[model samples]
Every structure is written in structure tokens, then in C-alpha cells.
Target chain A: MSRRRPSTRTVLLAGLAVTVVLAGVVSFYASGHPDGLEYVAHSLGFGDSAGPHVSDNSPLSGYGVKGVHNARLSGGLAGIIGVLLVGALATALLYAVRRRAPRD
Target chain B: MHVPDGFLTAQTSLATAAVAAVGVGIALRGARRELDDRTAPLAGLVAVFVFAAQMLNFPVGAGTSGHLLGGALAAVLVGPFTATLCISVVLLVQAIAFADGGLTALGTNVTLMALVGVWVGYGMFRVARAVLPKRTASVPIAAAFGAALSVPAAAATFALLFAAGGAVPIATGKLLTAMVGWHVLIGLGEAAITFLAVGAIVATRPDLVYGAQDLRPDHADLEIRDGVVV
Candidate 1:
């Protein structure tokens, strides 16, 4: 069979839909604790040994907007923002990579 | 796992960077040929989905949470070449934009998550497809196993990296045991999510699944047989 080619619009739309749905699912299902790596580091006694994050000074630290009172909402919104930003940025980068090829 | 800046020694970071650079270079070259219209956009979508999925961390024992790694998921959704590029984009975005991972350690992160994770997970899936029943349902099972195994494999990779370049004093055995042990449970979560995601995709758009080549029959024989065509 000839290769099936999904349009750029279709791909982007599908990606957006998947992002929103997965974000919602994960936000609802996510646990209220540190992750495995954090736990391992803690259990191994290097939890405190973690050097300060260079981005600690950034406005949104630890994937949460500063000054947000609601913990769950803050984190959930942060997750959404992260998804959108990462998706957009990656698409743009890849588009550039595909577009800016020297003539063969 | 997203290794931080100061987590590993300079030597370790440099070595991992070299490996990642080579892997990405290979992926880029391969992608030029493999990523056509359908795969190209689908690859981008997979990256977004992986990014979103990784954000949702499920709780493990002792209140520890784990999220989807997406190496296997990407590989199964797109081909391995595009999968590596997709995941590498996610990691790059995470490191640069969100600072989720360390900037200096981008090479290590990509090497572990993109190359190693994709190969192990996709390799297992390929083996499973050949040995297991030839059915659409089996796709999810294979995906589950692939996704589950990928996590601990990644943890093991990290443990190895730590062993070589670990700055903090810790027993390698304990580290390995702990990393692998926790990741095993984490892998279960990954499997469930991958199974569900891949299943949903296959159900809605079988055409989108690159890994479904084994399941698709020459003639459209849509039957519900366990060992037969799915």
C-alpha cells in the first residue's frame, strides 16, 4: 500500500486533543507525593544532597505557579501549560529542522 | 529519570553527551528518509502525547509517584527513527523551556530516554509480536510489556550512569536494587497507560499505528480470534 500521509493540520489537531485528554486524565489520577526518582534519592539518603536547581529562581518553580494557593489546581494548570508549551516548541523546532535544509 | 546538573560528574556527563549526540545524529539522518507526510506529523503528535502523559504521575508505594516514559509508546506509534527524534524533542523542550531536566545533562537524558528506552521497548515489542498470537488485541499486551519493561531498563541505565559518575557516596548495589525495584512498580503504571493509549489509538485509527504491521492482514479479515488475526 502507498504510504498514508496525515496532513499537518490533522497531526497538530490530534496532538492537541491527545494532550488535553491525557493531561486531564493524569491530573485526575496523579498521586499527591514525590516521584520514584525523588523517593529513591530520599531513601538512599541523597534527598537532601540534591543540589539546588538552577531554575529555582524561575517564576514557576517545581511546575507550579508561584502564589497559587490551591495545590492541586496549581499543579494541574502547570501541567497543562507545560504540555502546550512543549508541544508548540517541539513542533516549531521540527518544522524549522524540516524547512531549513540546504539544497541537495 | 531526568538527571539534574550536579547529579553526575563532568566526565560522566561528557561521555553520555557523546553517546546522545551520536544517537541523535543517526536519528536525524534516518528521519529524513522515514518521516514522510503521515509519519512526520504523527511523530510530532506522539511527542506531544508523550509530553502530556509523562506529566501525569501515578502513585506507587510509600506515596511515591511515577509517570510515563514514552520511549516504547513513541516507538510503537511511529517508527524507531522518528520515535527517537520525537522523544528527543520532548526532552529538549523539557530541559530548555521548563527546566524539568538539567541543561548540561541533556545528552545523558536523551541517551537514556530516547535511544536506550526505545531500543529495549521496541525490541521487546518486536519479539512479542513474532512469538505471541497474531491479533489486534495482542498489540496492547505487547505494548504493555514493552512499556513496563522500558521503565526499569531506564532506571538500570541511570543506575549504571550513577555508578560511573555518581558524586554522592552510595552503594551501587543498593542503588541498583532500589532503582530497579521502584521502577518495576512504575513500569506497571507505564504498561497500563501504554496499553490504554495504544488500544484507544488502534481502536479509533488503526492506520496511525506503525507497530500494527504485524497485526494487519493482507486481506481485511476482521475477526475476534485470540491466536488468529485480530
Candidate 2:
């Protein structure tokens, strides 16, 4: 293979590959502890004030799919779905709003 | 920080939503100027990457964890306008599908992480880049500096929002202290991550990095001595 710099397409594909692995596989091993804001809320005595999420019953709630008993698979499925959904929406919005070719 | 619903009053949530709407509208216009065919795809990838990274929460001592906010990294890779949109999209996906953040509080989350996080991080990056030496290497360093502070700055803004429209009657000062204190630790991790990501990309594709565009060495810098750069 030539030692020339890889094209931008290669770079983006590489990045997407890493992103998929992180979201779909590695995420299952992340810490289960509360995030900084949640910790602060609990410690500061407002923890109980938080209401239930409106989408708590979503099929992919809490990053896990319903009825997917295998913990890893459930989380991984949910994550991949989210990745696709977010990627599609973000890409569409950005593409639509991208600068058009200048009028001659 | 992804704020849960019910922590803030309905009125406050609505107000923040309005603010987020305005911020996003302006960003939409600004992003048009920033996004050409080349960079628009990168901006979308940034949102996807942030969504992925946020799923990997690192422990920050005391049984608490923090995840990547990604605003600084996004702003460094794409311009701030696109960075804001990127984060907003991630937050929206999380809210609707993952049930992570609240739907009612979506605007609040957007305001904090999208608007405040992106602008503050980008602003700090510019300030740091100006103070640091004018070298391509300094871009990631400056971005890291910005990442370090952006977390706490967003947290602090959340604290102020709580004070304004919090459902509970808590002492604002103590809440601010707690928010800032914990987030400061989180910010350190943010700095390290931002430095690595930005540095890696900047090293490989310096031309694609928005923040380093100015610092990139011009072709005019080359001095040809019989067709060999002196």
C-alpha cells in the first residue's frame, strides 16, 4: 500500500468503527454509579425532587432493550439503535442546512 | 450534565426550552456558513462519537462518575455552531429513546450542554490559543484547557438554573459549591480526553481541524533552493 495520507472517507469510516465498538460493546462495562449531577443532587438533598423520565417505558429505556434478558446484548442493541438514529438525524439536519453552491 | 426532569419547575423548564430554541435557531444559521460538503459529514460524525463516548462513564472517585460532554472536542473539530447542533442532536436522541434525560427537560439539557457548553468551551479555546504560542501543537493544548473548564462552567450554569426554578427549597450557595466541586474533578477527565482526541485528529488531519486552520503552516513558508525546501 502507498504511504500517502488516507483520504477523509477513510478517516471518517475509521472513526465510525471505533464509535460503534465503544457504544455497542464497551458501554456495558461502564460504571453503574450515578453521574456528577445526580450525585450532586442526592448529596445536596434534592435527589427526590427528580421526576420519572417521560420516556421511561421506551423500548430502549436506560440504554437497554426490553425483553433482552442478556444484559450485554440488551445494552448493546439499544446503543447501536441509538447510534443509528442519532447519526441519521444529525446527518440529515446538517446536510439540509449545509451551504449550497454559490450562484454564478 | 444531563439534568433529570422535575428538578426544575415547569415554568423554568419552559423558559429554558425557549432559550434553547433561540440558541438552536441562531446556530442553524451560523452552521450554514461553517458547513460545506467536506465539514458537514465530520460534524455529524462528531455527534455520533459524542453519543458513544458518553455511554462510557469513568469513575471520578466517591462512587460517582462523569462522562464526556464532548462540547470542547466537537467545537475543536467542527466550528462552535456545528458543535452546538451536534450536542443538541445527541441529547435529543438520548431523551427520546434512551430515557436518559427528561423530555420536558430536554431544553434544559440542550441549554446547558449544547449552548453553554459549546460556547464556553470554544470561547476558552480561543482565549487559550491567543495566550499560548502560535503553533499547531498549541491547538489541542488550548482545546484541552477549554475542555477542563467547560464542564464546571456548565455545571455552574445548571446550579444557577436550579436556584431560579428549582422545585425544592435548597440553599443555592451550597448547591453551587457541590456542583462546581464535583464537576471540577470531572473537568480534569474531560481535559485528558479532549487533549487525546483533538491531538490525534490534529496530528493526522490538521487540515480538517477547524480550530487549527489559522495556525497551519502556509505553503509560502517553504523556501525552495533548487526545488528542495531549504
Candidate 3:
């Protein structure tokens, strides 16, 4: 089969689809308790026992978005923010790489 | 395991920091060469997809939920070199911006999640592809195995880190057993998610999927031969 170039539309749509699904998942059905690792730590004694963190007072501590009501919604928003931040960062890095590449 | 701050002693953290620095330095150099015009954007997309995919929590027995680590997915989509860079970037951004992980333990996180996870997962993928039927189905199966296995492998890496720099005087064997056991279950979810993602990419853009390249032409031929063209 002859290769066809993927349109920007495809990438955008796919990216958006993935992002929305991620937000929905994070918003709706995340485990409320500590994850397996954390649970193990707790059962074995060490959970909540972390030494003082320098940024413990950060606004977005413990996966909670400050001033956001509805815990699930806060987490969902945080997830969305995470996606955007990471996506933008990755895109910029790649863009720089692309820019520096020798033109064909 | 996302090592929270203060989990490891300062000495251990600093030591791993040096190790991680070297690992990342190597990865950065490799990425500069491996990620070309075609591969670079795709790699960035893989990272974004991984960032998004990691949010989807699948149930692991008994109400526990886990997400995709994506080390396998990235390695399968890109190469090991680029995969490491992609994961490191994601973890770094997560630690700094979201505070999802500890800054002090960033080195440990990257080494385990990026280096160990990607290599182990991709290695499994190559082996599975070599053994399985050379077709589109193999892509999913291999991806599933690679993704699933990466969890325990990563858990083991964390266990090692904990052994070296653990805050609590926990038994290494017990910790490894517990982590590897739980992660083995979580690995199933990782496999499922990875299979679906790889299947989607293979279905739509086989050329873009690094792991699917070999199977694409043959699979497409088989589809035509069977009168079931995609």
C-alpha cells in the first residue's frame, strides 16, 4: 500500500480524544485510597511518614486543586492541566528539534 | 512506584541523582541523533498520548486502580533512546509542575520509570514479536506483554532503590515480593491499555508505529488475500 501522509486533523483529533478520555477517567473512577505501592507502605509502616517536603505547602498538594470544590472534579481538572502542560512541553521540545534539523 | 520525598535517605537520593544524571545525559545524546524530523514529532505525540493515557485508571483486583506507565508504549512506538527521553521529560514535568512525585527523588523515578521500564518492556516486545505470528495481532499481543511486564520490572527497580535508600527498615525480599506481586496485577491493566493503543495506531497509521512496521505490509497483504481490506 502506498503510504499516505497523516493530516494534522488526524493527530489533533486523536490527541483530543485521548485527552478527553483521560480527563473523564480521572474525573469519574479513580481509586480514592492510596495506590498499591502507598497501601503497601502503609501496611508496612512508612506511609504519611515522609520527612517534611520543601514544597509541602504548594497550592497543588496531594493531587488536590486548591479552591476547587468536588474532589473528583478537582482531580479531573488537575489531570487536564497535567496533560496540557506535558503536551505543550513535549511539543515545544520536538519543535525545537525540528527547527534545528537540516532541511531535506 | 512514585517515590515520595523523604522516602530515601539524602545520601541515597544524591547517589541516584548522579546515576540518573548520567542516564539522562546518555538518553539526551541518543535522542538528538535518533529523533529526526519524522520521529521527533511522533515521539512528542507519544509522550502526550502517554501523559493522557496514564490518567486512565483501570481496576486492579479489590478496588485498587492503576494507570499505564507508557514506558513500553513509548519504546514500542519510538525507539528505546527516544522513549527514555520522552518518559524522563514527562516525569520531570510531573514532579515540578504537578508535584505528583518528589523533586528529591526525581533521579530514582526517572531511572526506574524511564530507563528500566522502557528497556525491559521493549526487550520483551521484541522477543514476543519474534516468537508470535508476524501480523497485526502480534502487535497487540507483544504490546500487552511488554506493557504488563514493565510494571513489575519497574516495581523491582523501585524495590532496589528502596533497599539502597529506604526510610523504613523494611525487608528487601518482602518489599520486592509485595511490589512485584501487586504490580503483576497492575501489569495486566497496562497490557490491556497498551494493546488497545498499539492496535489503534497500527490500524490507522501503521507506518507511524515503529513496532508495527514489519507486520504492516504482510498484514495488509493478508487482509487483501482474505478479501477483508482495511
Q: Best by DockQ, which number?
A: 2
DockQ of candidate 1 compared with the true complex:
0.36
- lDDT ranking, best first: 2, 1, 3
DockQ of 3: 0.46
Query: Compared with the true structure, what per-residue lDDT tens digits does model 3 show for residues A1-104?
Result: 45564564586577567766676454457655566677677867777656655555656555557788887777777767766777788777656643265658
Q: Candidate 1 overall Cα lDDT vs. reference? A: 0.78
**Alpha-carbon deviation at A40 in model 1, angstroms:** 1.3
| Candidate 2 lDDT, A36-67, residue by residue in tens | 99998998889998888889999999999999
CA RMSD per model (angstroms)? 5.8, 3.4, 4.8
Higher-DockQ candidate of 1 and 3: 3
Find the 10 residues in a row with the least total lDDT in model 1 chain B: B214-223
Better of 1 and 2 by DockQ: 2
**Which window of ten consecutive residues has the lowest lDDT sum in model 1 chain A?**
A93-102
In candidate 3, list every pair of residues with a backbone clash.
none
lDDT of 2 by residue, B107-164 (tens): 9999999998899999999999999998889999999999999999999999999999
Model 3, C-alpha of B110: deviation from truth (Å):
0.5
